[model samples]
Target: MEKRQLTYKDAGVDIEAGETLVERIKPFAKRTFDSNVLAGIGGFGAGYLMPKGYREPVLVSGTDGVGTKLKVAQMANVHDTVGIDLVAMCVNDILTVGAKPLFFLDYFATGKLSVDVAADVVKGIAKGCEIAGCALIGGETAEMPDFYPEGEYDLAGFVVGVVEREDYVTGESISPGDVVLGLASSGIHSNGYSLVRKLFFEVLGLKVDDYVEELHSKVYEALLEPTRIYVKSVLKLLEEVPVKGMAHITGGGIPGNLVRVLPEGVDAVIEKGSWPFLPIFKFIQEKGNVPEEEMFKTFNMGIGYVVIVSPQHADRARQLLSEMGEKVFRIGEIVEGRGRVVLK
Candidate 1:
């Protein structure tokens, strides 16, 4: 047998394809640039100038991935919206600290580079930046040979924002008698898909296109709903109201994430039955036989973002948020106790 010469392409990595994908994505990324963005794609690094108005500004940065939800996207052949989830998972965390998103970057890695799929995902990233009022300054796309399964890729996002030094919403100010106002979620926002996939694929053997009456949609659509972005509504609330603390409900649910924003001697008590029912949760619970506590621990349930304000401002805060088109719920209150969360 004659030996064949090996090349990078033969090894399944195509530098030209990666370059071509970059060319295809430039215009999409350019659409998200703001005046603060000082450079374009293909640069060794991105450049962003601080916005001029703040007398004292603090930089806030966050990074997050889409988790196993990427598998659901692959199964549905829906690459676009997971990018939105990628951006949401990070920017929403920065929002908890009262920062305004200034720019975003992404990491995209795959076994093989599919221009169409990568472009679709970038489009969603650009759209999310627009929704968040940030610029998609840059990103990296890696085509690793035989690393990820065919037709599979992973996405992560990084967001940078700025908050006035005095305006940072550290939970230090949270005290007893503060009210917790929860903002409704869009549906299963970017957490707990390991169990979701087990229920849908392993246990129930449900297909991506399978429809359930509770969700009134295909399994993939319901599960892959983009994570909600609370930037606009939250920024508006901070402008007009005083927020003692805030939390972005993610992997650990209300009890988990909310506790991060409580004072040492205070606790949050979430009142059950205070908000509208989210049907997808009921479906997941019944289908997986998942306990209520585990479900709350793993998922966001109906509430995605929580704001703790003094009791005097609770109603006004809710009214202001509602006026801005947020589905507001008086979910709980802070009380004197060790820093913790209790649901009753």
Candidate 2:
């Protein structure tokens, strides 16, 4: 009888592959570094120096994962964009409170580590941080044998931001007559993918590469459009406009998310048709035969983010956002009522 020696790689984990991925992604992460990033990738823990300015600085933090959207990316063999969706999901949430994103971190886990795919994903993450004006400080990559199937991985992100204590937009200031502005979404920005997949694949029998005239792109292209990052634009608008409240529309769509920001005495009255519904949404609604209310609840529809300001500041806010290259719409207004959202 003889015994055979086994190594980590034999167990489906490649230590060398992990190290190689670290090397490949270093340059990508470094590109997002700012002076405040005390230490970046390859460290046991990343370090960041808080910018010195606010009298009472408040640290805001958010964490999120790119829910089943990763499946779409994997099916399409598109690894890069979902990383942006991961960062956008977290950063946008913290931005709702007027926090300026300071840094980001990510978690990637899979059965077998493919250095090339992982690198592409990290590259996209760095790109997201650059767009967000934040440093990609550090992250973790785990190769768990048999945990995830081959060629499949999951992503999660964490972001830290800072805002002055008095400057935090708590939605408490959202009152009657405040205008609700809708910021155009970049088509199916990271939500409702479960239904999307069903409609396009199982029901419609569409392939990832199948092109549809209505969407003007392949199925995956429309479904995997990276979630829009509103940090820079919203942060800039906050400086010039008194944004009473802000909501990063995610899983629950506009009504579910926007209602969270309404004060006890006000309701958000969203006027339908005020904003252009992107073709993807229209296609999903018509193809899925999803009811109007269900569409608003499950998907962002068109608005990725919502900002509330006094009527006096609405026009100015819209102009500034538009000048910043955003498709801004005066979609609704706040009214006196119990805290809720009403679509008209």
How do all models score by TM-score?
0.97, 0.99
Could you tell me the lDDT of residue 37 within candidate 1?
88
lDDT tens readout by residue for model 2, 55-122: 99999999999989899889999998988998999999999999999999999999999999999999
RMSD to the true structure for each prediction, in A, is 1.3, 0.8
Residue 228 displacement (Å), model 1: 0.5
Q: Per-residue error at 19 for model 2, in Å?
A: 0.3
